[model samples]
Target: MDTRDLARIDLNLLLSLQVLLEEGSVSRAADRLNITQPAMSKTLLRLRDVFADPLFTRSGRGIQPTPRANELRGELQELLGGIDRLVKGEAFSPADYDGEITLALSEYIGVALLPPLIQRLHDLAPRLSIRTITRIENQLEQLAQGNLDFAIQIAQTTYPPAYRWQTLGSSPPAILVREGHPLTEGEVSWDRLASYPLIRLYISDLDHLEIARSSEAFIRARSPQQGSLETSHLLTALEVLRSTDYFLPGPAYLVRNEQATRGIAALPVPEGASYELQYRLVAHERTAHSALHNWLWEQILDTLRGLRVRTIHRG
Candidate 1:
């Protein structure tokens, strides 16, 4: 129905009429709906006025439906059934899902997370097309525009009303170095770490937002940003760490147990460095009710938890 027509009509009257039609007794309908007799009588009056018909009549036992009320029974049941189906969508199956899903995350985070995550997607949703974007400059704006379904990045301290986010986990960055590096031999201190040139893994999206107790912020406070190399790709930065005395500071938990990180070791940031980041999975309000979006969201969350658990067990 149109908005103006709907505004004048009370949907509850239709439901009350449905119950009254089924029970054929005002008192019985009131009892079923847990309402007082007078309340039920008032509802009947409203229903009559809305439908412009004396829908019921007094019978010797209880009541009898007028012809109009009898006329409404079959259509009312069918309409209500249709509405029920409309509210509850069909059962979701990943195999049936062939929709495209776009996820925005850094390449480093994807390196360790994507393998197991994609494997699950391959097994479950073979027909689905997936695209991952890296070096995201403005994830929030992208989320608002429906360009990205979800973003895995350093969690912000606050978000504006148009967004929704969930914390994936804490992100304490690790100083990744080649195996048998001098830092691996002994305790890592600010001065000891400062002695080596650093590799900055820039998250292009986070540059606009201010993060509290951020790993990069803490390092800037302690030492000069002495980067021998700064790059977007983790593979390239890790290759640099493998060759020279440069140290790469980035997401350690993601690559800790990965086969690609075999020759690399993730050492803790020096003591008193307030570099703990809360990684958030951010999405727009538009996708809040979407079946495919919610399913993929759960899969990403579950896959991340599984990754962390395996890291713990291996440690």
Candidate 2:
């Protein structure tokens, strides 16, 4: 039916149609719906008028469904089932869910968080699927549109009123280099680091113009390291480091585990460096009230706690 026809249809007619098709007898359907036989007959007549088809006909003392009525039965059953669930006001149970949850994660947070998060999901909700997106051009917009359930990243810019975020942890920058790189063995001085070309990982959602101005200032006052290969992907930067003497400075938690796995190591930042970064767990205001999202967010916080502890130990 067209939208206007659908708008004219009554919701009670759908329920009555479901009961009539299941029972196959007008009298019995009325009993099931706690209404009189005449009232149920009136509803069936209204259904036939709306559908422009005789939905049921005589079959001895019972009723026989017309082909059109049979055609609508399966679709009506599913629609009513959704309505039932919505009205039930039931608490979400992960074990019972068999749907996919989508979230956005930047490269570093994905590396640090996905392994443990996937493991936990497997243990608790094996059938539930998780789809993570890394190439997000607009995180908050995606979240508000229900395309993302959660996102973990550094909030360098102010968020709009529709977002709810929690700080994961904050740390100063650390330099990452290949295992046998010269900077790893010697005293890592700003001048020594500046002597080699650097791989710059571009994160932080702050305006790019502001980042450029700040970067220029840092280069002038601190070191004249040319950001030879700048990218949003940390793994790409790490791959560049494997064959060359280039190193990148970033938050420790994002690189610590990847460093050990890839034969890379961290060098202490110069003692006077003042740059600090903080990661946050972000969700849309719409999803912040969801029990399932809240549960997952709490697990993320717990994971970050362990990350911070291990980073201290590694230092």
Candidate 3:
């Protein structure tokens, strides 16, 4: 806390602490830092003195961080990272930057957005590698901890203060049936829809649908059971619809191009029905200032906007 305490702290020691806290083994930490075991032990002793806490203690084969150490671990990584960035003092150039960017997005967005996004990256940042993962639990926590560069999913509620979200577009749910289906030729009404078996594509990644809640309630009241065919896979729902009288009620634009030829055509929802979902791009507050990240974010928004325009024209 004092100048003398600050003078005793070394950046290298801080990094060593990060590795030690992560690895929980002095030898392993030393190997990671490419330092001798004795040197690592000495650095740990210095870190203990500087922090005035026994940072780690023996726990079976490996060491466990104390409560104080556990608390310091998070702050230490961020602190060391900022210091490292400050020391490098290099501008971010997307074309020349060669690092892997991890993104967390759902299978739905992966199908709709990945192709265009990856193509854009290839054109602009040839050296940049993208690794996409499915949206997992504790998504915001993962994003804030730098596990994900960006997440493409539906945000049903407000995110924590540390996360930033950008609305892409909202798509009202539509009834998808075969090209020559009765609903396609007639006035599609909730009464008519309830007369046939429904194919529901359940998006497990969503906590709950923003606009689909009423639709869900109405369906439950009508059927009081799961859809005749229920699945999380969009293709599966479409496939079932292609072969059966089952009608799919989900995102309006899910069926496109080649799949549209699979006897798939969208039917407008009945009057006063509010089944829709708003997709958005969520990122950590820390990434907002990075030029490369911001550019990528803008490209995503632009791609989604174009898709919305095309959908509107087609509608």
Model 2 pairs whose backbones collide: none
Best-fitting candidate, scored by lDDT? 1
Ranking by TM-score: 2, 1, 3
Off by over 4 Å in 2: 2-82, 88-91, 184-189, 208-227, 258-263, 289-291, 306-315
Candidate 3 yields a Cα-based lDDT of: 0.77
Q: What is the lDDT for 82 in model 1?
A: 80
After superposition, candidate 3 runs with Cα above 4 Å error: 1-89, 218-227, 255-261, 306-315
TM values, all candidates: 0.66, 0.66, 0.63
Candidate 3 is scored at a TM of 0.63
Model 1 ranges off by over 4 Å? 1-92, 208-227
lDDT of 3 by residue, 165-231 (tens): 9888777777788878888877987677777787755553445435546556446634544357766
**Residue 76, model 2, lDDT:** 96
Alpha carbon lDDT of each predicted model: 0.82, 0.77, 0.77
Global lDDT of model 1: 0.82
Worst 10 contiguous positions by lDDT, candidate 2: 208-217
Query: After TM-score superposition, what is the CA distance of residue 197 in candidate 1 from its true location, in Å?
Result: 2.0
Q: Candidate 1 vs candidate 2: which has greater lDDT?
A: 1
